[model samples]
Target: MNGGTDLLGVVSSLLGPGGGSAVDPVEAAARVAWSALVEPGDAVGGLLVQGLGAERSFALVRAAVDDGPELLVESCRDAGLPGAESPSVLTGAVAEALARWGPRLGRVDVLAALDAARAVGARLLVPGAAGWPRAVDDLGPHAPIVLWTRTGRRADGPAVAVVGSRANTVAGAEATAEITSVAADRGCTVVSGGAYGIDATAHRVAVAAGTPTLAVLAGGIDQLYPAGNFELLRNVARQGALLAESPPGTRPTRWRFLARNRLIAALGAATVVVEAGARSGALNTAHHAAQLGRSVFAVPGAFSSSASVGCHRLVAEGRAQIVVHPEDPVDTVLGRSRHATPGRGRSSSSGTPVLAGREDPEVLRVLDALGRRALGEQELAARSGMSFAEVADALALAELQGLVVHGVGGWTRA
Candidate 1:
């Protein structure tokens, strides 16, 4: 801690104007090292950092470089850190960690990471920082050691995590938009994984609603992954906040994506999955939320849908409650009364526009599938990912109100 003066100097210079928690310069500098040295979900690293202060933890790693686990384990045991009670077990773990960390030791350049953050006007946040979201502390040993944030604004309200598949359907998109709209109306911050499909839709709606939206990234704050969402994420960084566990130049690996989901789940008071396929990553987020004892909501999708499979499974297993009403989940989580149910009528004064049949999931799915130029039942069924029987029922209802017209080519918009 005392010898990191050069690191402290660089950190002082690179610290930007973003809203941040007040942390000790030495502690913050050591965290920068940990963030740069380890992978996103390094449980060993997290445990060590939490057991020993960042300064001591970093020093332990440095000391163990030659002195070995003898020094590291003794230090942790002396600190009364759990797991150190068994010296043999802790020694083996520490030795493995030290070996993995040795190669990266020489490369830990605190200045480079800070410079990259400074270049993007990002700020560093460590646990106990003033701006740190306390909800994430629920992660316990899995908590992030450091969070690199751009815009650095701290949202002052409850947050809801909206997550879904990257390959989303119209119904899924509609459901996400509706949920996001209601969340924003409740003055809740919307948290998302800054990916495509449902994640993108939720962010767009939250942004349009002028609500504080947080986008957690798997990569560095300097490089927003999923190139398609760069602008949208930039908008979020400009207006609300963008956070990452990695330092400034880290590329998002698959492991990191899964790791960042925990951050998303922890940040929100509740996590809602609008749509997810059998293998959707959003389910991982829901799992993380559930583990943290956060409320989880799943919007029902067509039984024929491949997208909602994960959500359906979650509901069936009672891991998550079904979202009968978008606002119902939000209401329950925030412990407030629901707004008057969204009828198939005009937009409310709250400025939440209601789409016809927005209350009817299948009807919304069918309507969204109809598009500018539509086809017959067969195509509609395929396009909407609905069974022909479901499409027929929806089309029949829509045609009764001139919502569609059957032509020689097929069914087109009326």
Candidate 2:
């Protein structure tokens, strides 16, 4: 047999009975050598044995048995070793595989790792792909190896991540919805971790607004962690996508949750912390965003509310922008007005210079009635008591005159 095939057989043998501590060192070395040959699509039986050595590797394999073969291979590959191709490998095979491959494992760089992952049915997403989130690339090296996604449509728009504490207040939930609604209406996707509280509210509102939203999960894409969010996650998958770095069937763990925060931050143009305690996990997302150079905004709550403490600290430390409302976030991202001078109203008479100045009372009233929410032409006519033709003329003039802004569904005050 070739080195690779021979190593595979030896690993299988070491995994069998009597291959425990009684196994010969040379046989054990061969078993370890076999593990180094693991590539994507290899069987898991031998790999499992190689991973669970006579002692340490054994327990590790047993503990991870439920994680599935893909995850096992990933773990092995990450450890710079090969995984067994079958279950019958001796317990000592893992050490042997490691020893054999240890010297030449330098070839298994990140690119090779990605190739291996793809060979095993997992898709590798890099920055600049149609579905590649700009937010994630901002994470630098801390970013995930690859995002394993299983959705029909990949998200392809600017996304605002809404994160907060699980035990959020009623006001926090309301704010999350309102902010998410604003984002959706403005053509921004919403990204969250599919957790309870603010994350769930953001996704719900974004969906209601007919906007795409993405959910990053700490567990496998196929496995929903918080069982409570299974249905919600399904809806997100239909409307947007559910992304995970781990292969399917991997369970969520505490470390995974922490690492997942960086993904959330990197996937968004900006992150808004609606509510979080002093030490809430949401803060981790904010930190990741700041580190990635993405905008981090925080909604301030009452001084007495524990949930708002983290946000307050973030803003005070200059790590985040203080967003009193959703518009503040939008404006921050779009940038401040270049002209310092105030805008002027258009003259009713012909031959007037268009300059930055205050608007007339009539125009102000019309805009005030329109509010921040978009109003259709007919709605604006009815609200402003202007004739249909006059409203159309006014709206057209307002847009050209820079008194108001036009958007997809309707018009909103500039």
Candidate 3:
């Protein structure tokens, strides 16, 4: 093993100066190592990083590999790993994680990965870095240790993930464009996987609209996957960013794509499916979003269209809210604003920007009217004894408060 590798020196030379980087050099190097050492979204690995920090965890892995996991239990405790409640459970989990990680310790060269990354002008980002987006932290123990990105330190705004099948129809493409256009129009960063159909459409629209976008790759940012989107990925990197969890020289595998879904889901406030077949991989992203408690929406197509089968399944199973209105995705991303552009508040002294969801009478009234089902403004106004404009504004305000969610058909309690 290259345990003697001068991590600080290697990273300092390879990454150079990053304009007062908040990340520790050794921590950065260790993250680059972990990105290759473990598979994507490894909860045990995430926990190790969370508890021991990247640099220390990397050392722990190296030690366990050379020796055995038996001696590392005390080290884990000394390192302050927030293991399971029971001591035996903690010991068992550490043993299992070490067993899985032991094989890769000697194979991956952290310094080489960093050198290759810098060779391609890719920037390395570790947790707590200035440009790092905290949203992915929502995944908790499943979060990534490092992100290799080309531009934009963090997404840092409203983002909605638009994804669907590679074999998309013209209609599906059109719908995807509309969603992306409206989202970008409202100043939301459209996040996607940079795949062929719907993902490409979303990126193209975001780029064309001159809005920030993020394309999260399953492989490496050094080589854009799907050879066709090379230029498009470049445009995305230029306007916003091209990011990946896998290190340089890594290929996209089926399991990696599945792991990538959780990242796409975590990066956005919502996930939108334009079109998909019964087994479309986009469904995987949607399911991940649902698990993370992020809103999910699916655009309905013709009942007879096979491409829409998975979308229909989402609606039928009550997993996703239907995108009945064109503004739904925009609302999902930018929080249902009717007049204001996404940035800054038009608030006076008493604007009620952040409701606690129950105290405000207007919010409570809207929630009571919403009850169990989604309703349009007119129906809510009539039911809640409020005027149409009042209901509209209240719903808009409540959407931001997370007290209610507008699913296009109407509004419902969150």
Candidate 4:
């Protein structure tokens, strides 16, 4: 038998034991076969064909074959070249499994796939890659095994995760936009799952601001989860990166959504829950951020609104900092203000001044309103009277300035 098939058989045998502790040998073999068969910078199609199962393998092979033998021929051409073939096969195998199972597999399967993928890639970044974010890993082991990425021409930078409910209030949408703009001005990349409400707002604002933003897909990178966000996803990929743990052609699943949250948390220096109910998925993301040791922030809402409950609870439990304004630049809330501080008169080319002991005036106003008590935006606005737009603009400025901090419920002085 060809070494590829032999490897698959081996991994299959290991997996056949069907016990909690048993490692699937077939999977291990698949990992080996994948590493042998594919190369870095090679077309993804050829890799899929060489590593996938019988039924799926042939289909993918056919697609690549039909596209003309360029990719397949290249794979064979580069097979023995140095740096072309990776030392570990585990990553390819795990990535294949993630693609195959889609969202059906349990936490064990996901972890195994991630482990294998990282082993093979030799760049196993979890929530702690130098850029490993504590926010996403807080999801615990349910976190993604690897973040398959291909950076762009621009420098890789910090990102903020903006997430909220699908059926969100107008206020929520506005908040997302304001917060995203602030992040962009601070030279931070905005990360989101590309969902509705807050996620959409965050992306749109980032794009409009001419800043880089990334979208973490719960499904395949080839397909956008929400059909409506297809254009937005494309824009993000062009400006920044679109990431996925699973290979192409996978569909979104409930468990994947929960798992996907970790990516947003992990990628972002800090996580902001824009608007979520007690049971909202955004709250789940906040929990993961806490677990990962990332700073958590929240935007407070109306006391009577169900959407505000999650943020309120997070603040009460000390799980999140309350953000009253988007511009408050304290690291305690967004976890990024520390990096934004000026270093000996050096200013980032972006023109946004680094924090240097000075504070944003808008953040000061919001803090004065919070005064050791969590206050919703409406109350803060009523007390400050600065129009909603003015308040939002100030908050966004303050957040970037590191003068104030935001959390689950509202904003406070740092």
Candidate 5:
């Protein structure tokens, strides 16, 4: 076979036979090539892949090696890929990007990366893959070319990220574990960077609770960082997923970590900051979550605590809602039970009642049956002694009234 056919075969073999809903192997290989060709969050790479298909874009980049990157820019403009940005601005941006990307061109070996991923039992998930999260689409031009994932199964529920300072206080650690336990027990997948303090606490608690947990890494799937959290990350991989945009053996850099924050924020339905100092990386994730229109919650620490300035600022600026207890209504919005906390009413901020405390008896029955755990429509119907249609009707009304929420895991009380 020729080199082109040989490359395609190697790519296709990684996905294996009967890999349902996996992307075309050739296109997937091109994406892996792009991931290595440019740094994370490379806008130029994003535009090329977005405007032209990945295969065509890869061909253009390869052609540019001899023809000059300027030709690629002109081709993009000719293809009507340049939107709104003035030609002069686009010209300079493309020029600067070319300087950065050109040197890396020779280093891209799609087949080697694909082989590395296969060796590690990882799969390349492109945009249309069966279990790709729809939330990251919010990044637009900044979305990852592909995600390298090692997962046991696709989580049935949406995740909630718990992020905070690496130098977190004891209170912050306790808070992370508490909130994670509640969220996981209610069938929410827990997501976090595999870092120390709060991120580690969140992953550990979620794994212990038998809930799916995803650790979005700054490096490659093969090179887990922070070495101290190796065991925890391994458990996370077994129970949930280890996701990265980088190929195998890539080292974590400062810029890569910053770029990695976007994925964590985009993956979660909501992000909760347990404790963060001023200018913390957790704040970066919170900003990304806010930009994606996802809920941001801050756990308030003592006013005297230096580790909480970011959280306080977020709350005061109205960028985040204050979450003092596990049962706060924010969890409900993500389809976790708002009544999950053992002593919810003990705190005065039980939040306003849904429908002014005069809910329909059928809706109330479903909510009671839901408790803190997720229940599918049929299970809810069985437990509530209501028909499937009645349960559906009740769930819809309750969700509309803010009394309950329904997500991939089914339904839960609000």
Candidate 6:
């Protein structure tokens, strides 16, 4: 097995102390190599690297692989890493890992990656490095092996994530841009997974507002995904920052996209899901944010829209608070003040206007029919001039947002 000697030499030459960096060359090279060695968000790889130093762990894995799959499984069991304590259970896992990682081991070139990053003025960032975002530490064992960063500047305050569906609506995109701009202007950095729709809108607005926005990518920084956003990502790299855990030459895969969500969630002080379906990847980021003890916010969408289902679910279940306006995150991070810009209106849907820049035309009509009295679904549908089916869907969403409630009598405005 290749011990990555040539890879180390290349990294050493590229990461010399010319920039006044005191980081060890060997360690940097090992991190770059390790990033290529395992997939992003590999908890076992993180555990191994943290338990043993990256270089030592790299050597151990290499030696074990060279010793063959059986020996590798034995070594893993002896090391007592999670999922490996049971020798029988670990054997298959080790063999599978060997199959996945072995063929690519000889192909990684840390030098090429470093050179590619340098060509674009990006730097390879490891833990403990200056400008590293400490918030990512919240990921614990699932933390990234290395980060490729464009901007050398780190946020002076907490970063907030703005995420949502790629097929977002105009209102959702507008909300993301507006919210991100407000937060950035209020001294927060905007972090996102750098997909289209909401992610693109957030980054553009933040940059235009002169707020530092971080684009957390699934693929290599050198290989920006969604080819359509190439220029936009380049602008982000130049003006704000572009970050990726994957090394150069790595393509964005479905698994990588899912794994990258954790980084976006962990890097933020809070996560705001602008719009998401029940199965949206933005929800995944929200889940990670909640797990890390970060506040999760969801922007309410029109009740009839599928895009808003996840956000409504989050709000109704108390998993997240409703963000009616852009300044909610700013208030959470910088502390609420009388002088702070007003949010959509109230924190909860109770006693708050239903169509406050949220409800669609149909939803507005249905809400207007509710008035101040209780009405059955059929009666409300007739009064609102909407179909019964439409009324039912709208009421479900309104109830979830706490805008309306059902009781012994029927439905009433909350």
Task: Go through the candidates in order and give each one's C-alpha lDDT.
Answer: 0.76, 0.59, 0.75, 0.55, 0.75, 0.73
Determine the backbone clash count of candidate 4.
Answer: 46
The stretch of ten residues in a row with the least summed lDDT in candidate 5 is 341-350
lDDT of 6 by residue, 1-414 (tens): 233676655554444344216566677778788898888876556766776668877776777678876655565567676667566545655555555577878877767778787776667777776656777876876789888877745556667889998889999988987888788778788888778889989988888887788899988888877888888887787667888889876789765777788899888877899988865778767766766667788997998998988888777767788986788877776642333432222233322322232445765677799866556666788899999888876665554344554432346766
Off by over 4 Å in 6: 1-21, 69-93, 335-414
RMSD of each: 16.4, 24.6, 14.8, 19.7, 17.7, 13.6
Could you give candidate 3's per-residue lDDT for residues 72-173 as a string of tens digits? 667667766665445675676666567667788778788788778888888777776656768899888778888888984345677888999888889999
What TM-score does candidate 4 get on C-alpha atoms? 0.51
Worst lDDT 10-window in candidate 2: 344-353
Alpha-carbon shift of residue 187 in model 2 (angstroms)? 0.5
* TM-score against truth, every candidate: 0.78, 0.53, 0.76, 0.51, 0.77, 0.74
Candidate 5 Cα outliers beyond 4 Å, as residue runs: 1-3, 16-22, 329-332, 335-414
By descending TM-score, how would the candidates be arranged? 1, 5, 3, 6, 2, 4
Kindly provide the TM-score of model 1 when superposed on the true structure, using C-alpha atoms: 0.78
Q: Tens-digit lDDT track for model 1 on 159-276? A: 8899998999998899999889999998999999999999999999998999989999989988787999989998898768999889887888765777798899888877898888
Report the CA-based lDDT of candidate 6 relative to the real structure: 0.73
- Candidate with more favorable, higher TM-score: 4 or 6: 6
TM-score of predicted structure 6 = 0.74
- Model 1 is weakest, by summed lDDT over 10 consecutive residues, at 345-354
What are the per-residue Cα lDDT tens digits for candidate 5 across 6-74?
A: 777766665545432366766777888889987776666887888887888888777776687677767
For residue 217, model 2's alpha carbon misses the true position, in angstroms, by 0.5
